[model samples]
Target: MSHIPYVPASTRYDEIPYRHCGTSGLQLPVIALGLWHNFGDDRPFQTQRDIVRRAFDRGIFHFDLANNYGPPAGSAEENFGRILAKDLAPFRHEIIISTKAGWNMWDGPHGFGGSRKYLLTSLDESLQRLGTDHVDIFYHHRPDPDTPVEESMLALHHAVTSGKALYAGISSYSAEATKEAAAIMRDLGTPLAIHQPSYSMLNRWIEEGTPSLLEAAQEEGMGVIGFSAMAQGMLTDKYLGGIPDDSRLASGKVNKDFFTDEALGHVRALNDIAAERGQSLAQMAVAWVLRDQGASLTTALIGASSTSQIDEAVGAAQNLTFTPAELAAIDEHAVDSGINQWWGVTASR
Candidate 1:
């Protein structure tokens, strides 16, 4: 309960493995908790607190958030701030908090995009809502087509240099844009630290296209964190029989068109592979993203609605290896399932 004094598990560090985030000295849990869903005001506050507490107990110190994560927008951050104030504030030094801007967060013209005014103001607001003076990483949520990439990178540079954010990150960026952004940040002396891309068994955009986003991040010496590793729960077993009444698809949170019969067929095949490997489909999906495929990702960002999901995701670190045969089998069914809605925005410029 929120009223009870909280104490983290002493064996928390021993529960999961940590990897260096790119070439940086900073290390992150192989699986980080994402507040993209279920942390909003629509969910019960107690349920939110339980999930956060369970994640930390499982050794997930990294918490990823964004400005427009809630149905009302900004409520996820506000709820997380309350959790931090009540339970996690004492362990702040052990936590890595990250938040992003660049998405539409307000109604006015200057409310969104990569403009310095918007990004800077959003960071200040995020800090306030997070109940902290700084975030470990501040990201430009996506590539702004109209705004020059230079302007966005400069805003992130300012975020780090001004001590409001210790690092800079970009999400859903094309490989070319990633290179350009990384160069600008490098020249600005900020050195872009991470790239968050949507990658999963069903959506492999980051690995498609020339050079691939994975290669670009590795080449630029930036860490890679793959969000939606479970493909908006498509890669999980929840939809195998059919969309559950309580599922995201049934709730209309995700595109109904994405779960075409062809895609579901591929999912079924992948689920078989996971079972053969003695893991759940969700666990396999997370591990697959963290697999040491030439350009190894630094971490897998998973959105969890309950403590069980957090446990399954963190358990992914226990077995990240895949035999050549396993990889070959997965290749047959890991084809893109038309679930990447962000591809248009990412590849726009």
Candidate 2:
């Protein structure tokens, strides 16, 4: 295909739904785009552009990325930056772009943790790769066990104060850490804007403390947005007939051994219930994560490999409700995937 000029849909906002992220006055789309899987050097640039273009055309204006999101660290950000510069630059203010640090991006002592040096240096490199002056949300990807929590939080504060990020959020932080970090930010006068954790019916570690997390976030006015709602695509129908060649399981992102026989049985039962709900397994799975909006969840982060996947995932925003019986049906099979990276985390409820 030739390099085609992109023209975004004019009625895009009419296609998707948006909700407030915590209490910070930022309304994010019900479904946000994640650049974790694709948008790498391994993928074609035009295909990456098309997926992002399609997502924006459907009203998904929030794009999420982390510094180490590629097979080779930093490729995803480099690719997305190219797309942003070439295509979305004109509409930059209309979108909420978020990126994170605290992962293994480069070799050496200062490259992997939440020190001021690492966080600030990483954001600068990310901005250069993203081809932007600042991001909408800058996150600390995880808590550094060796670094003092105050130091990490301080680095995050600097991002906002220095104008490198409009707001600060944390990912994979426990409820206790969120409380402490929220307080640190509060004292600094830079209240947290959101929390990003991987959540799905299949991995509910975050669910264990959601009510309390939301309560605290509400009291402090912070919002929560969840990622991995599809469990790397296991929640979708593609695995019902055994893994396809192109599936994430085959690609090794989702562990094939994680879905044991027992897990498969639960998946099939859940798929049947999804069918009854008039949704694809993927749609119901995505919607299930957002169905508990009363908990103050701002959005569900979705990742797509193609334009068609983007179209299908957007359907999650359409039917966001469920009955008592439907909720009961889902619980019967919503077992923990055991592959959730944030499992075993506990916080006061």
> Of the candidates shown, which would achieve the greatest TM-score relative to the real structure?
1
- Give the worst 10-residue stretch by lDDT in candidate 2: 340-349
> On residues 49-168, what C-alpha lDDT tens digit does candidate 1 reach at each position?
999999999999999999888867999999999999999999999999999998899989889888899999999999888889999999999889988888889899999989999999
lDDT against the true structure, per candidate, is 0.91, 0.86
Root-mean-square deviation of every model: 1.5, 2.2
RMSD of 1: 1.5
What is the TM-score of candidate 1?
A: 0.97
Model 2 lDDT tens row, 179-212:
8888989999898899888888888876565455
After TM-score superposition, the amount by which residue 100's alpha carbon in candidate 2 deviates from its true location, in angstroms, is 0.3
